[model samples]
Each structure stands twice: as structure tokens, then as C-alpha cells.
Target: MPKDTMTAEQRLQTVIRLGVPDRVPVDPMIYYFAAYYANITVHELWSDMKKYEFAINKCFNELGPWDIYYPINPISPEAYMFILPMKMKLAGLDLPPDEINQVIEEEIMSADEYLTFARSKTPTTFLKYINFLSTLACRVQREQQGEGIFAKTRIIRKMLKQIPVWREEFKRWQARDVAVQHGICMEAPFDTLSMSRGLVSFSYDLMDNPGPLAEVSLALSKGYVKVGDWLTKKTGVRRVLVFCHRTSNDFVSPKQFEQHAFPSLKAIVNGFVERGVTPFLHCDGNWNKNLEYLYELPKGKVVLQFDGRTDIFRAKEIIGGHCCIFGDVPASMLAFGGKEEVTEYCKKLIEKAGKGGGFILAAGCEVAPNARPENVKAMLDSVKKFGYYS
Candidate 1:
């Protein structure tokens, strides 16, 4: 399998199918790093689509070749936010230009609201509540920061105009061998409830009133599957990224996770698998206690991506040949380590995790904003040096 024989997309797909490709596919989770490389503020990158395109294109052209490029920030839903009246700091309204917008976690819904939502059991109802909370969050920021309302309107206008332009750019990038992986983004049901209901309250509900929360989570899982199906049909991309934040051992005990989180998460994974789509689990936090549970999933239909907290070496030993695995390179190394150090670390990763043919080399999580450019290039270069299969 010579490197020249397959396109970057094909090379990646080969690994996804548990086959050795010409090289281990390099797909760093990049977002604000684009703003850093392009010498623009994160605000500017999200405020204008052209700047966003330029920043990402600069990364591909200057940084090094990438098998896949995430064209937009996962948290910032470009034009769709215009239709749904919600505001997030990631969209560049409340946060400073250089900083990534933080998720302001607050208990917006009451315990009774969970029962109400479950009864309604409609995606529109759930989203309306979320949007309401988001709108209130924006109002609070405006009052506290002394910001004006007109800025949001301007951002919305730019996003509407940029939609078509972004599509065209994606097509162009795909033709250039840098395929864009875009589809519906979802959070595990428990994580979604945590965001809307507040982690403190949700934890209590899991103990005091686990029945209602479990029912609501089941309903939400169905909604997520429907949204994923619609997005796949609309965009012709059969993939979904599911953010499983609280399911990790950092937040829940292994017993709690198995009881409260795993069922809904497995339901979501199974739903997507039944529809012929691949579910990429962005399992953040240290999930050491829960790694074994992943074996229950439909093998080859999931890509288990880890943050630095998860022991990816152990994960590879457990699920390497069963499913595609990506990541666990510490963000700290990329942000502060020298190029030589980064290259050495990458070699170690390839030797351990890249052994069985179903590994994609990536930064454990999103490349930090301050990660050295030379270190990133070293990551891409390491593939050529050590990622080949005979």
C-alpha cells in the first residue's frame, strides 16, 4: 500500500474499516488553532465566513497535509443558529476575540420540567427550551458586559450570506484530498441534560428521581437519532459526532455510568448504526473504568476518540481490532513541547496503537490555541516517517 496509490479520504476509510492503509490517517481536532495560525481572533474567524475559510485553508496549505479537515467549529453552528434563536459565546458574541467561548453551565430547567419534556417527547419542544435558556444567557451577558444587541444581528447576516460560500469551499477542499467531515452533532442524553439542567441538579435527580430522568433521556436519544438521520440524508454524510462528557469516570462512578449513562449512549450508537452511519464517540475525561463497556457496541460502526485523560494504550489493547480508535496525545505536549519531543511521542503512539491497522493518529482533543505550529507540523510529518504498513 504505497502512499501515492490512495487518496487521503480512501486512506482514512481503510483504517475505519480495520485495514492497514498507506499511513495512519492524521486528523487533528482543530478549531481555535486555525485562528491562532491565521493570526486572527477567534471572534473574527466565526464572525465572517471568508475569514473562517481562509484560516482553515491556511492550516491545510501551510501547516501540512491533513487527511480530513473540520471546516467549522463544532460548537458554533454557522447559519442554523439564525433559524433557532439561541446564542452561544462560541459564536463570538460575549467572549473576547482571542478566547474560546466557555459554556456557561446553569440550572435553567426545573426537575418538573423533565417530566413535562418527556410527556411532550418532541424535538421541537426540547430545542425550544434550550433556545430559551440560551437567549436568557445572552441577555445576562449583555447586561453584565454592557454589550449591545445589534452585534448578534450583524453576525447572523454574515452567517446567512456565508452558507453557500462555505458549501462551495467544502467541495473545493474535498477535491483537493482534504475531505470535510460534517454532519449532525449530538451530545449523549445525560450530557445534554447536564447542560440544560445543571450538573449539580442532574446528579441529584439521578438519585432522587432517576425514573423521570431515565425516561427523558430515552426520549432525547430518539430525538437525536431522528436529527442524525435527517442530517445524513440532507448532507449525504453518514457520520455523527456524539459528545459524551459526563459519562466518563471523571464525573460518574463506573456503576452509575453503567446504570444511567451507558443505556442511552448505547441506544444512540445503535440507532445510528442501524441507519448505516458511523458514530464517532468523542469520549472526553478519564474513562478507564468504562472502557470495557464499549465492546458491547456494534464493532466497526464506532470510532472511539479519547482525550488525554483516557488511557488510549489500554484502549487499543481492548478494542483496537474491534473498532477504529483515534487519539490520546496530550494537548500540553503540542502546546509546549519542542518539535523533536512531539515527533518522538507520535512515534511511540504509532508503535503501540497503530499496530493493528484501525488507528488514526490525532491530538487527544482539540489542538490548543497556543500549540506550537512546528509541533503540529511534526505530527503530520511523523505519519510519513513511521505510519506505513507493509
Candidate 2:
């Protein structure tokens, strides 16, 4: 095979532009798993990030040398940074730090709040809820951390102090010639609604009160663009990470997806593309029936990343040239399968989804906290063995 002829960013951008690069880039989304793979608890990763960085580098040098650096978030992810923030059973707070956290799936918005939300012309109504929730969060923090008046103040102070950790992560990765994977994070409005109203209630709302839900979703997508744009300017990274799972074909019927999900999602995606920023969608569910719908997006401007739930092979058939595809390696395989089992699956992925261009090899969603190191190494090494292009 020929030696690499492009830089890491060049290779990634090549796929983004719908062109073949020297090789396929591997971009595993190693979130809490990073802490797990290193035998460090998730909470420890957030609390002592320099330690996190060292362990991550060790993973790369020993088992990885993977393309794209997944940044150790400087800000604690447990905090309220979501576009449509809602209560969650956060790790290290409501649950064990290392255990998978829950979304609570409880209702925050009542049935009556929908009309008022849609009718209001300004963001004041939205901000009012956010302010109320934020204050509630402060008390939650104070109660969880301590009982003193200055307890909340002390905890808030510590959260702000982690910004340097992210800077260090970025600097270290850039210095090492690895591409950093981070940007302004946002979510699809419909998904937010599902979580806020609870899925069962939201499904009823979809049936009986579709109009307001649609209107609220549209407004939230627009709001996301505004917030994402401002953050992009501040961060100087021209990428937007949009998390969309509730709209997938497996979650809702095709007709419902097109009606309630696709429109608002397309609006948010195109909104970012229009502003010259790339929207990297973190698709969290099966999207088989919705693959054709993705072609409605601007050609070569957006990335449709899949978890294991999506059929990546058929996806390559549908949107190969129209958009870049990332991921589909099952986390189960990484955490349980033998090295040979993992390697065979990866080779299959390379031969099929990677035959042309516009493919990124990554764990379907994220590397599991209990993923076998040998299996991860096998996944990482497959690219070097079979990923190169002539």
C-alpha cells in the first residue's frame, strides 16, 4: 500500500466533500468509555482531566493510533448545556458514577404548555422555562453536594475551573497531529419534546395535538442554529454536532418521521450549512427507512453518523456520495467479542461501506466502559491493515 499522502484533517475533509482520500479515518466516540478503558471511573475523568489525558494518550499509542481525537470535555457534561434542557438522573449525582446514567424520561412540560409555547412570538417564553429550570438545578446541586449556603457557590466554582482541561486536550491532540472531534453540541427539537413530555405522552401529543408540537419543534431548531452559530464564532470551530435519535424509523413510523421529525431536523441541519458550518449528526437509533430521506439534505455538507441500530451497508448504497457516513461498529462486539470476531466484522465494514469514500470507522455509538482492550485494538488495527486506498 502507498504511504499516507494527506494530513488527518485533509483526509476527513476529503470524505466530507464526497471524494476519496488516501485512507479511511477511524473516529471512535470514546466518551465515558475512555475512563472505563483506562480503569478510571467516569467521575475521576471529569475531576482530574490531566490524568484522563494521559490515559487516553496511552490508549492511542498502545491500542489505537486512531484517527480523530475525541476531546475530554473541559466542562462537566452533567451540567445544563443542552439546547432544550430537562432533568436527568445524572452520573455521580443520582446514580453511581461509573454506571450508565438515565434520562429520567419523566414529564417536564404539561399538555397545556404546548399552545403557549407555540403562540409566543419571542424567546422570552423559552428563556423563562430555562431560567426556572436552571435555578432548580442550582438547588439540586446544592442539596446533592452540601447543605451550607456557600456549598452551591463552591461547586459552581469548580465546574468553571475545568475549562483549561479542554484547552489542554485540544492543544495536546493538535500537537500530536490527531484531528480533534468536538464542536457546538445541539439536539433535534422533536427529540427534546419526547424526553420533556415523556415518550408515551409525547406520542399522544403527536396524535391529538400535532400542530403545537410541530410549531415548538420548528422554533427550537431555529433557536439551536442561533446558539450554535454564536458558539461556533467563539470556539472558532466550524462544526455543529446535532444529536438525533427519537426521529429514527425504529422510534416512529416513516410517515410520522417525515411529518414531525424530518422537517425540523432538516431545518436545523440546513440552517447550519447555510451559515457555512458542517453539521455532524449523531444518529442514535435505526434509520433504515429514513435513509432515502437523508438525501434531502444538502449534498456533501452534512455527516450522518450511525449507531449499530442503523443498517450501515444499505446506508452506503443510499447516501454514499450525497453525504459522509460515520460509524456502525457494535459496542457489544467491542466489549464481548474476541479479537478475531471484531476483526472480521471490521473487515466486512471496510470492504462494503468503505469501498469508495466518505466512511469513518467508529464504534457504533461509543466504546463501552467494559470493552475489551484487545477487541478495541483489533478494531483500530483493521484500518491500517485493510483501510488504505491505492
Candidate 3:
């Protein structure tokens, strides 16, 4: 739009391609805050498709100038029954409009069940859907009381009607030249296990029953590739965000991670790469111990994004010029730090990570609900002031 060397989309693509762009792209992970700013309850945003689109567009109008636009959560109606099985105040129909949707993390499968899944010839989708429905039923029972049946039917109807609407919304965003729509999001196998089996249970499984856990991890990795392929075909986007949370150093020792996490992660990355999609690794938490393993994956085909927990500067030194590195601005700073504090910190981040061409400026994680709008403004402003390649 400004007649720069690259369009906003091109600017982001340049960094993703491991080349320096005319300026560093400003991309932040945004979620609940969108509804917060739009003056709508999270329930309305996720339950009603039309309102969801309106609120997201409102967020774009109000907070943007961003290179990449990520429509975080309440992805689609089918997503409710399939990809996300969590039930909370806003997500489940019986709850109040003000209640927030939350991911229900419980070990739905026993240790032997994991082994059974690994050995079964059944389609992973069938298994996952069955498990999701079971979990949803359980949630409905607990939260819906007598209204469960009616509420569930209403929610499903709403979702079914919105499928086409959501597709059209994505098409409209894709037509916009100023911003790139983020593609499909997938999680690494280990993280999937952590979510399916509560962290405590998964931790125990890892230590007490490593064999079944490893088998299940491999099975999940294979399933993810199939899922990624399906999503790529469905959405026509070739980028996948492979979220890896529990695999971080905060949760496991180096040996445990190498044994259980790295193999499946490698498989998933390779599987996606083989299918002609770029994998963007959202490796949250302290991954200092596993930084070296990232190098083992194919170069220039992956973008590594870190939450504030990881030492991104060290990451820059380890993989900086070779791979595109996305963030580390503490969410806490964005939430409580003054404008000047935010500005200075951003400047330093740019000077260090933006020195080469492959860094994108962003908060370590999602800009929290309490994050000051002025601080966010400061973040965008700092990029304009210091992120230029000249």
C-alpha cells in the first residue's frame, strides 16, 4: 500500500523465507481480548458466527496494521465437536453469556487405552471424534443439567449454519492485500497427549509407562500429518502452526524430551514439509535444552516462534540467521509496563533480533486481556521507528 519494496503479506513472507524484509513484521497472538475490546461476551463471539466475524473485523479495524492476521479460537462450528471438545460457560449452550470457554483437560483414556489406540487399525478421526463426543457428553451432563439435550442441539444447528459463512469470511480476508491470514493450526504429538491426558497423568505415563506413551506419541504424530493434509486441502493454505507446549524444558528433563518428544516432532515436521506446507513451530516455554534439535529439521522451511519463557536472544544466536525467529516480549510487560518501558524494550528487541532479516516483532505469547492498548500501540509504533531495513 505504501509502495514499499514488499506488501505487508510479502514482508511477512520474506521473513518466513528467512530473508530480511524492508521492515520487521508486527504479529501478535490475539484471542479473548478481541471480544473484550468489542464489548461482547466471549460466549457471543464463539457461539454466534456472525457476531464472531463482526468482532474479529472490529479488532482488525481498531488494532491492526499487522502483517499477519490470526483469528484465534472459536475457529468454526465443526471445530466445537471435532477439534476442540472443551466445555465452559460460554462454549456450552446452557452456561451464561459472560462465562468464558475453557479447554477441559482430563485423561479420557487409560494407559492401556493408549496402547489400544496405537495398535488399532481404525481411522484416527473416528477415534478422536468418539473421544470428543464422549467428553462433550460428560460436560453436558455436568453443566447442562436438564437443558443439555436442547442446548447441544441448538449449538450444533448454529455451527452447521455457519460453516459456509465462515468459509466466506476466510475468502474475504484472503482477498485483502494488506494482511495475510494465518493458516491451519496443529499441535505436536506430545502436546496433544498432554491435552488429552491431563498434565499430571501424562507425566506419570511418561515416567511409569514409557513404552505405551512412545507408541501413542508416534500414532498421534501420524494422525497429525493426516489432519494437516486434510486441513491444507480444506483451507487452501500451506502453513501449519505446530504448537509444542509440554515438551519444553520447564516440563521435562533433556533426556526425557529427547527420548519422547523429539522423534515425533521430527516426524511431524518432516511430514508437513513433504506435503509442501511450511511448519511454524510455536514452541512455548523454556526450550533452551532443545534448541539444538531444531537444527535437525529442514532449513528455511520452518519458522520458530517463542513465548516469553524462552531466551529468544540465545535462540537468535543458536538458529538466528538460519531460521526466522518470532518473539519474546513478556506478556507481563505489555500488561503492566508503561509506554516508555514497552517502547524501550521493543527497541532493544529490534536491535538484537531484527539485526538480521528474519525476525518478526511480537509479544512472547498472546497479548493478555489486561494488556494496555497504549502498550500495544507502542509495540506497533516501535516497529515503524526501529524495524526498518533501509
Number of the top-ranking candidate, with TM-score as the measure: 2
- Model 2 worst lDDT window (10 residues): 128-137
* Per-residue lDDT value at 281 in model 1: 91
TM-score of 3: 0.86
Model 3 agreement with the true structure over 229-329: per-residue lDDT tens digits: 76656665677777786789998888988888888898888988898878888888899888987888888778888988888889999988677888877
Q: Which stretches of model 1 miss by more than 4 angstroms?
A: 74-92, 121-167
The TM-score of candidate 2 is: 0.88
Q: Where does model 3 exceed 4 Å of error?
A: 1-3, 75-81, 84-96, 123-166
Q: After superposition, how far is residue 193 of candidate 2 from its true place, in Å?
A: 1.1
Q: List the residue pairs that clash in candidate 3.
A: 20-357
Clashing pairs in 2: none
Model 3 worst lDDT window (10 residues): 81-90
List CA RMSD, all candidates.
4.5, 3.8, 4.1
Global CA lDDT computed for model 2? 0.74
lDDT, each prediction: 0.73, 0.74, 0.71
Write model 1 residue lDDT over 84-143, tens digit each, in one string: 222356535666678876655666567887767666633484353343323333333333
